[model samples]
Target: MKKILALVLALALVLSCASALAAKVGVSMPTKDLQRWNQDGEYMEKLLTEAGFEAELQYASNDVPTQLNQVETMIDDGCEVIVIAAIEGSSLGAALDKAAEKGVKVIAYDRLLMDNANVDYYATFDNFKVGVVQGEFVEKALDLANAAGPFTFEFTAGDPGDNNAGFFFNGAMSVLKKYIDEGKIVVTSGQTEFADVATPTWKTDVAQKRAEDILTANYADGKKIDAWVCSNDSTALGVTNALEDNYDVDTLGWPIITGQDCDIANTKNMIAGKQSMSVFKDTRTLAAQVVKMVGQILAGETVDVNDEETYNNNVKVVPSFLCDPVFANAENYKTILIDSGYYTEDQLQ
Candidate 1:
């Protein structure tokens, strides 16, 4: 009877030991202003919880210092791993360094921090490829227009301070500059003509006013712009609004405008024949990969990222994973966003 009781007790102890091995993870997000980030965070939380790890999430509301403080707090809370979507790449250096010294694993989500090397893993879409697609889409759209003479245009880029923003702008401009040199597309006010081309924070009002001012000065000089290459959906929408407010979009022939992010309003606008196209980098796939990585880390299994690479200040050629980005126009609007459950028919309508 004592032997039987002892065996049962030993089994219970083993079960308790198994349960205690599961760890707590900390997730810090820069902001939830963008719909994708919010979705990504929720997906990560759900997956981590289901995998038997506790998740503590915090949002910085776009404040860099606040993100730093949150990381410090997560480290102090004895978190086994920290996932960061840093608000500003430069400001995150100090916090990441400190987290490394504590022997905590760090995963850089979406945007990689260039200044630090403490990150153990990174999962993000091919941001440079995203820009390339945006540029190529603009090129194709312009070819369809087949304008008669030189076409004047303007470019509205994202926050200049961010490295990803610069890559996006550079990639887009690389293709755009081809036409500009060939004199096929006339850039009246952009990196060449406009004095204020650097967008610091991606503020909507600032974008609107800049477009308004550009149209007032450049386009008003008897030069009708054939296209406007706004970087992302938000900026593209602002530029579209400014154009419509100032001049008749119908009369202007709705200058071929390009945008990214697959934003709800922008996707709807694409269906309604307003915007041209948007680059859709599915956040769901990205979230799933991140969850898988977290699970691997928890199980003491190695995650594979040899196919992906990025340069960090501390670690050159950091292992990373990048997914493909799709350019969604009117044709694939339903098939991509709706069919994939990213948006519903009612949502688009």
Candidate 2:
């Protein structure tokens, strides 16, 4: 009896030691409203935990104050490092200031955290390349280089606050602008600027309403629009929903709608011939890289970064590791999304 009690106490001590030694990591996601974010948060938490870290993941429901409060709570909860996917890139300065005071390291995940020097590193896809892929998809689908007499084009971009939104719009514009200038493409409503076309919070309903207004004003004459460059799946979903409600597919036909994230619904739409293509930034790859980075940061090793000059966060240039992105359409989604195991064939169906 005495020996058994001693052994149990020894085991308890060992368990406590392991718990105390494990570094606590705080992951603050912007929202669970978007499926991609849900996946990102899940991946981050899982990978961090698997690497022997205590990971706390929180969703802010797209609320800035709630996210700020969550960050503060994590800091008080003894998190040594925090990963943030900001709802608004610039709104986290105050929260990060507190983190800096406590000597907490910050890794800006996916979205570039802006206007604050507290950010230690950035992990994201090549955002400009994401846009470029989107733009290139539009150019190729329309045969803009050759077959266009005059094609109707429009833009429904992402949140104005996300630093990535600018990169996405510019990359696509760089390809399509020449066509627009040559009169190969027409912006019927001329809502060409990012500021004008950006959806607040990347909200699908907002995008749908803006698209509806554009259709009501510009395409009411029954001439079909050829292409719409949407920055991500949420906006593309919005535009798709709006287009379906307002236009008749049998008579009007679907436009070449380009998006990012290859979201499940949008994938179904692609299979149904509604959406043209999407930029697939596999979150699994990014999550693994971020876990590697967190490991390096804790181990006092030099973290890996590929691009040191591209991402300037208003205050300083953030050292970043950029993962590459590729576009997926109906023809290649099976290979890129399914065979590679990012999604099951059943999930897509």
Candidate 3:
């Protein structure tokens, strides 16, 4: 009986030690202003905690200084691993240096961390493919290849600070540029350049003002725009607002708009015919993958990464795990989003 009791106590002590050694994980998101970031933070926190890790989640309100400070604090607080969704990709070099000093592992979440060899892993959707999907959606809608004459379209891309912005813009442009060269599509606003059309901070007001200017200059006659290829939901929201506030979309015909993130407002707009489609990269699946990666890392096992050559952060080729993205529109938002429990019907309504 005493030997059995001793065995029980040993098992209890082992369990106690395991609990005490649970590694703390830091999840730093760019902003809570966007619905997707909030969901990402929540999901990462939940999944990490459930996986028996201590999780610290924070939002930086889209401020680079705030994000740097938060990451510094996470490192100082003894976080074993830190996951960052950068407000600005190139701005985290110093903080990552600090993390490296403390031997903390870094994972760039959603957004790539630039100019830093300290980034150990990258986990995000295939962002260029996201743009390709958006471009394809526009292609199918306009029937660009099969159709005879020209179609009018506009561009509204993401923040210049985001590294993914170029990937998104270039991927879409790769498909649509050929058509433009062939005179199969026209840029009515004459704002085709990335530097000209790139929105700062991906701000809705900024994009809306730009769109308003373009409309005033070129679309005042209520000429129909065939499409607007926006990099994400917020910019698409701006374009939709510009159409509503400044243009006679009813008579001129609402143009097809492409977006990413499948944001609540954008999905509602898709339902309401204001926005056309969004790229759906489900965050829960990504969170789960990151959690699994965390376990592998802590266990001193090899972490699963699919793409080793794609994401070059200007320091080294950062290993990456790229989740595939698909288009979500009025037609399949029900199955892809609501039914999959990514969002509920009422939340969208």
Winning candidate number (lDDT): 2
Worst 10 residues of 1 by lDDT: 190-199
Top model by TM-score, which number?
A: 3
Q: List the residue pairs that clash in candidate 3.
A: none
Clashes of 3: 0
Worst 10 residues of 2 by lDDT: 14-23
320-341: candidate 3 lDDT, tens digit per residue: 9999999999999999999999
Residue-level lDDT tens digits of model 1 in 1-349 = 9999999999998886566446778889878876666877888888778777888888899888898999899999988888888777667777778888988888888777766677778777787777788888877766734645576667888876565676677777777786787787777764553225655566567788888888887676446777777778878878878887875666667777788888987887888788889888887788778877776776678885744445454555567877788889899888988898888899877
Which regions of candidate 1 fall more than 4 Å away from where they truly are? 1-21, 144-149, 190-196, 306-309
- Per residue, candidate 2 scores C-alpha lDDT tens digits across 1-349 of 9999999999999886586449899999999999999999998899998888999999999999999999999999999899999999999888899999999999999999999999999999999999999988888777889894699888999999999999999999999999888999999999999999999999999999999999988887787888988999999999999899877667979989999999999999999999999999999999999989988887788999999999999899999999999989999999999999989989976
Sorting all predicted structures by TM-score, with the top scorer first, yields 3, 2, 1
- Residue 326 lDDT (model 2): 94
Overall local distance difference test of candidate 1: 0.77
Model 1, residue 160: C-alpha shift (Å):
2.3
- Which regions of candidate 3 are displaced past 4 Å? 1-21
| Predictions in order: lDDT | 0.77, 0.92, 0.92
